[model samples]
Target: MFCDLIRGAAEVSICYEDATAIAFLDIQPVNPGHVLVVPREHYEVLQDIPKAVGAHLYQVATKLIPLVQTASNATDMNIVVNSGAAAGQNVMHYHIHLIPRKEGDGFDVPLPFPGSVMPNRQQLDAMAARIGSMLRDPLQNDGMKLG
Candidate 1:
């Protein structure tokens, strides 16, 4: 569907659009101005998207923040992107959610790394080391590629 919206095959109330990306209202909006932005090209996983396009997504989201906030009278913003199924990415197509927020809205964005307990400093360092080793080429994460 996002591809359909971008292609004009599916009817969508697009709020913004350009050669590289597009923004539109979410059907199941967390708030009235909740919007979703997506790259013009279809990509399921973050690793598969080019850096330029990924950067463009953030640019578009940043650009939309104030506009959406003003429109919805939102006091805060929740910008989110879930990369994989384990990360809560329901839609395979890559996208970003721009949820408008207000005080006592009764919604809380889940922690990025939710778990039972916090890790100690030593454990944190080990975790960072494990991921830092893969920073050189995140797309090829030693058989951990999402796509």
Candidate 2:
């Protein structure tokens, strides 16, 4: 599917492209100027992508933000990625969504919870420490040289 897009055979409008990644206007957009940024190489999910490639995808996405905002005259934007099937990922390839937001755009953004819960300091600290301990050096594990 993506190979077709890259080759200009998919009939989708191309917005930006470089050697590492490509950004295109989403055919079914939430709002005008919505784009999807994808790496040139296949990566099924976030974890499957090399850290440097993933960073490049995001870097391209970030660079396009101002352009999308100006073109759409959007007040804000949402950078989204549905990583898995359960999380609404229909495309097998990894991509970052660039959804432009304007006032009364008719899209209701939902929160993870209806109300915020304040966790105790001890609980928060413990959770942070546990997560920090599990973070591996990508270079040591995968030999990824991220700039």
Candidate 3:
């Protein structure tokens, strides 16, 4: 049953595999070199994923980050998951999204612009600076300083 599921995977350009987990390309990708990391055993979503399976899947996903960046020539990437129908999950199989991102991809996965209220250049720059500063020391003001 599990073998069949893995076999049915189409448009997969597998970069890594193991006894328990496998990482492959996403057929209907939002961007180039988008990949899916999945466990060999079938699971509907994050809540159903076994602890061992989840651990191995995450390990493989972490290891593939650098590879994805190098292969796709991207400066950054997004690791995402849509668990259910409400969350936009079309597939029953549990998987992780490894999307390689460039400067301008026309698809904003993190931020969305609803309506016509767009921020001016100054506002945008201020927002960017705030985010950058927070990112530099995320735990500082949050009372959880990093070492």
Candidate 4:
């Protein structure tokens, strides 16, 4: 769907464009002037995008933050990248949403979940160690199991 927008087949109110990426107003915005920055090349997932292209996407988004915020008269902004289907990503092609925020605008992101529990210190250590081990070496196991 986004590829169509990039190819000029579908209509888009483009705010920014370059060889690697394109930024346009979202068809259905969380707030007015919400912009979506996307890579020109089709990438199904965020990890599939090359490091340079991924970095470029963010760099462009950062540059656009002030523009969208000013246009929307927003007090703040939320730059969101819903990476996968499980993470509320409706679109398969990875894109970043630069949403302008205003005080009492009532546009809430569903970040808080009901009945979430805090982990103990040991659980936190074990989780961190697992992630750290994976970063250092994918195959190496810290052998710190948790329930």
Candidate 5:
């Protein structure tokens, strides 16, 4: 279904396709020749994806990076993933962004804040330590095993 939507769209120029993945242009692109690399499976997010599928997706992306750069004539690019709704993921299917960037492209990624109050480094470290301890404790028994 997802592949159909991508392939059917007129705006997206397909750069590559394989059994496991497809690379196509982004309709609402951040830059010229912005591409979306998606797995053939319909997994919603990275955490839900099986390791083998995830590896395949990464391999596809790696293979297409140079092709996208050459085709778009871009010196550099940004690869991004928005895993959930809160993270600006409009689609439920898993996809990786490949945005071609050039000098003075008149694009600016929004930062969280302009020199806003930042979290204390020491406090963050302490919180991480506490979380690590809780995660290591067998009593918690959360289904997630961080081996």
Candidate 6:
């Protein structure tokens, strides 16, 4: 699906394109001129994308923000990335939403879990430590394991 869009096989209007990625107007836009930035190469999730390509995707997204705001006459914008199926990512391929915002636009960006309270500092700290450890060693084992 994404490949077709990038190759101009689809009727979607193209907003911008480069060697690494493409930005196109959203068919069902939150506001007029809303856009989606997608990498040329398909990645099922953000973590699956190479760091360089991921960074380029974000760079393209940043470039679109001003264009969307100016074209839609929006006061603000929201760049959203739903990483996984559990995060409301309908498409398997990675894409970033460039939603333009205006006063009383009536588009609400609800939290993943509404009315959730913050945990205590101690609990937060402990969780962060565990996550940090995972980042330092994803398998929870020293970097001795091979593919």
User: What overall lDDT, based on C-alpha atoms, would model 3 receive against the true structure?
Assistant: 0.81
Candidate 4 residue-wise lDDT, 1-147, digit = tens: 999889999889999999999999999998899999999999988878887899999999999999898888998999998889998899898999999998888887765665668889999999999887776673554343444
Q: Write the per-residue lDDT of candidate 5 for residues 12-106, one digit (tens) a residue.
A: 56788777787888888988889998887788988888888888888888888888889889999888999999988888898999898898998
* Residue pairs with backbone overlap in model 5: none
Query: Residue 109 in candidate 4 has what lDDT?
Result: 73
Best of the two (1, 5) by TM-score: 1
Give each model a TM-score.
0.86, 0.82, 0.69, 0.90, 0.79, 0.88
Residue 97, candidate 1: alpha-carbon lDDT: 95
* lDDT for each residue of candidate 6 in 3-83, tens digit (9 for 90 to 100): 788777889788888899988888888888789899988898987888789989888888788878998898899888999
Residue-level lDDT tens digits of model 3 in 1-147: 334547764445678888988888887787888989988787888988866788888889889998999989999989998898888888877789999998888768556636558879999999999977886785745543446
Give the residue spans of candidate 1 off by over 4 A: 110-115, 136-147
Please name the candidate that would achieve the greatest TM-score relative to the true structure: 4
Question: Measured by C-alpha RMSD in angstroms, how accurate is candidate 2?
Answer: 3.2
Clashing pairs in 1: none
**Candidates 3 and 4 compared by TM-score, better number:** 4
Better of 3 and 5 by TM-score: 5
Ranking by TM-score: 4, 6, 1, 2, 5, 3
TM-score of 3: 0.69
**What is the alpha-carbon lDDT of model 6 when measured against the actual structure?**
0.86
TM-score comparison, 1 vs 6, better candidate: 6
Candidate 6: pairs in clash: none
lDDT of each: 0.90, 0.87, 0.81, 0.89, 0.83, 0.86
lDDT per residue (tens digit) for residues 38-139 in model 1: 998999988888878999999999999999999999999999889999989998999999999999998897666476598799999999987777864657
Alpha-carbon runs more than 4 Å astray in model 5: 1-3, 6-12, 110-116, 134-147
